[model samples]
Target: MEIILVPAFADNYLYVLRDPASGKVAAVDPGDAAPLMAELERRGWGLDLILLTHHHNDHTGGVAALVERYAPLVVGAGHDSHRLPPLGRAVADGDRVAFGGTSAEVIATPGHTLGHIAYWFAQDEALFCADTLFALGCGRLFEGTPGQMWESLLRLRALPDATRVCCAHEYTLSNARFAVTVDPDNAALRARAEEIAARRARHEPTVPTLLGVEKATNPFLRADDPGVAAAVGLVGSSPDRVFAELRARKDRF
Candidate 1:
């Protein structure tokens, strides 16, 4: 499987997943059709499927246009049918959908949106997690509570350490800054912050981050850690409470 990152409006990222063996391709959250269509034409690839993680405009804005152009099978959360574009296959948690020679396990990750979902291609060791997860942070709880978001994050935390996280935006640099402010004593986070600065300076992407790296450095995923809990003034609190405090502080930051 080959993954192509297509930058969309501002920091949004649209992805193209291609199966080299079958030459079949799928678009994941196309924010715009022009760039994606151009990329497909450049690579001489035909779109076969459209996978949506959530109903956010930045994620699904180009769906109608692409559907008209490629006539690909659209797949999205059945629970969010009213909000999503027409879905050929409306899936829920644990549903496995085949693409080319492999299949992706659908994980219902509801936090960014009530019907948000992620695609885990185990064979490819890739997690196409839209706004639910980010490079150095997690998504804002716009439609869900802090508890729901925290639980959703815990689910993602259980994935293999080496799994590559394909998040949907370029928010790493700012997230890193916020992370260092909250976890100032964390050497790993400090190192990562510096690296993020350098990468952004070069106009390079810091995505597709290793889950292990996030586990060690991301404060949002480390709410259970004593250091992180104390840093956020939730020393004796439960992981959920710590996470809530962290999220609140991030909202103000």
Candidate 2:
């Protein structure tokens, strides 16, 4: 499976997962059709499916347009069917769907939204985590509880070390800034922030970082570290409290 990242609205990303051998491609979160359609036309790839992780406008806004043009099958979280654009398959956790030759495992990751889900393909070492997990930070809990978000994050963090994290937005630079503040003595975070800044200066992307690397630098995934525990006042707090405090600190940051 070849993963193609397409930048969409502001900082959002639209992913195209393709089976080059079979000449079939599936788009994940086509927020708008203009840019994605052009990209498809340029590559001469046929879009066969739409994999939506949530109901947010920036993630599902162009679903109707794309479906109208390509008539691809739309897949969305079963719990968010009411909100998601006309969907063909409503999946839940543990459900598996096939793309030309690749398979995507639906992971129920609710935090950014109650019904938010992520697509994982171990064979390709990639994940289409729409707004749930980022480079150095995690998404804000819009509707779910802190405990729910924490557990959800833990689930993703438990994935294999080689998993390539392809998040939904260009938040690496901003997240690195906040992460350094959250853990000032983290030398790795310091170095990465500068590198991410340079990438932004060159107008380059800073994504597809390995999950193992995020474990070393991302504050949201370091809730057990002494620095992160202290920063979030989690020394004697429950996971829910820690998550809430950590989120609050990021909000202020």
lDDT of 1 by residue, 175-221 (tens): 99999988999999999999999999999999889999999999999
The model with the greatest lDDT is 1
Model 1, residue 146: what's the lDDT? 82
TM-scores for all predictions: 0.99, 0.97
lDDT of each model, Cα atoms only?
Answer: 0.92, 0.87
Query: How far does residue 114 in candidate 2 sit from its true spot (Å)?
Result: 0.5
Lowest lDDT block of 10, candidate 2: 231-240
The digit string of per-residue lDDT tens for model 2 on 1-253 reads 8888899878988888888777788999988888899999998876899999998899888889888889999999887899989779889999998987788899999888999999999888998898899988899888988788888899999999899999989989989888887788888889989999999999999987889989899988877677777765568666567667888888787
